[model samples]
Target: MAVEKFETSLKKLEEVVKKLEGGELSLEDSLKAFEEGVRQAAFCNKKLNEAEQRVEMLLKQKDGSFGKVPFRLDDE
Candidate 1:
């Protein structure tokens, strides 16, 4: 799939895992599915990491109060 949203990528990753566990695909097909799954997993991990950074920033505000804070990922 092309650049999917985080939820969509996670759902596709789950589907990929199910297909691999079912053991019905040929070796080549299984490898392809595994590669897709890896991509999705990496996307999800990056998203989660960005979110964690945002939360940490919010918690570290100088006023010692938890509140919404604007965030920008370094690479963005």
Candidate 2:
């Protein structure tokens, strides 16, 4: 599947998991699905991180004003 968007990629990953669980595919096909699933999962994770950063940059400060702040994962 050509994963053009995060939602599409996530849905593809779910389908891969279902196919793998069904135990109908051969070893080589199963391996291919697993690899694709890994790629899709990484893509979804990266998109989520980007969205979180955007939200963090728009956070309201203590002074009741919005400001762009560098988002640091370690701060969590």
Candidate 3:
């Protein structure tokens, strides 16, 4: 299967949320949209996890003098 970019999946998930919240779809259509939203959420989560792992790996000391440090947002 082909992977969607994180930004695309996130946008799709947001749209699904808006549709569900708007309460305009039939039960069947709502169910389908909910299912798609779940899928997009999972894909986005997976991509975020992969990125976090990469960041951790990159932060490790090059000369083996230090271990990997946890990543934190600068604003946090």
Candidate 4:
């Protein structure tokens, strides 16, 4: 099968954990799936971080020019 898109990968990761937590997959398969899901989730998170950085880079000041802006990935 083709590699899933970022959004699809994220959704699949969620589903994977939900299924594993529900006791639907065997021990071995659950471990394997959890590993794969973790990898996908990391990819999704990286993409999200990159996108957020891009948005911050596009922020314009009152002078009507774009420049790098400070953006916090963590709310805390």
Candidate 5:
């Protein structure tokens, strides 16, 4: 779909899901839609990881300034 980023892809996927949920598409089309959704899900997961790392790097300390912090997976 040539999305600029994972968030864009995820939004597109959400739209697709809404359309499919409307019960208007054929079975084959729905299957293809689901496959694309899986790919988008994976991309979103990767983007989430990268975003978490960036957030950790920019975390503010008690001094009201940014400081480096460990990127813990559970932080999200």
Candidate 6:
């Protein structure tokens, strides 16, 4: 799958949803929009997950140094 920037994908997905909800397109067009919207949503979700993982890996050292630490949801 081609990678799309999260912001761009999200904006496109929003436009697709607006078009779909407007009920102005033929069934075929609506289907196409829905498919593209799905793909965009998936891309946005993937990017968010990756960012969350990166944030979780970050650690602040006692001397104000930065380090890497495994992320743990339960520890929070």
For all predicted structures, in order, the TM-scores are 0.63, 0.63, 0.63, 0.57, 0.58, 0.63
Q: Per-residue lDDT tens digits of candidate 3, residues 1-76?
A: 2355888999999999999999999999999999999999999988877743445434547776767665678897
True-vs-predicted CA distance for residue 76, candidate 5, Å: 21
Clashing residue pair totals per candidate (backbone < 3 A): 0, 0, 0, 0, 0, 0
Stretches of candidate 4 off by over 4 Å are: 1-4, 52-76
| Pick by TM-score: 2 or 5, better one | 2
What 10-residue stretch in candidate 5 is worst by lDDT?
48-57
Model 2 agreement with the true structure over 39-74: per-residue lDDT tens digits: 989999987776432534577889999977676677
Candidate 1 lDDT at 22 equals 100
lDDT by residue (1-76, candidate 1, tens digit) is 3445888989999999999999999999999999999999999998877644333345556877686667677997
Q: What clash pairs does model 1 have? A: none
List the pairs of residues colliding in candidate 5. none
lDDT of 4: 0.78
Off by over 4 Å in 6: 1-4, 52-76
Judging by lDDT, tell me the better candidate of 4 and 6.
6
Assess candidate 6 and give its TM-score to the true structure: 0.63
Candidates' RMSD to native: 9.5, 7.5, 7.3, 7.9, 7.6, 6.0
Provide the clash count, candidate 2: 0
Query: Superposing every Cα of model 4 onto the true structure, what RMSD results?
Result: 7.9
Q: What ranking emerges by lDDT with the best candidate at the front?
A: 2, 3, 1, 6, 4, 5
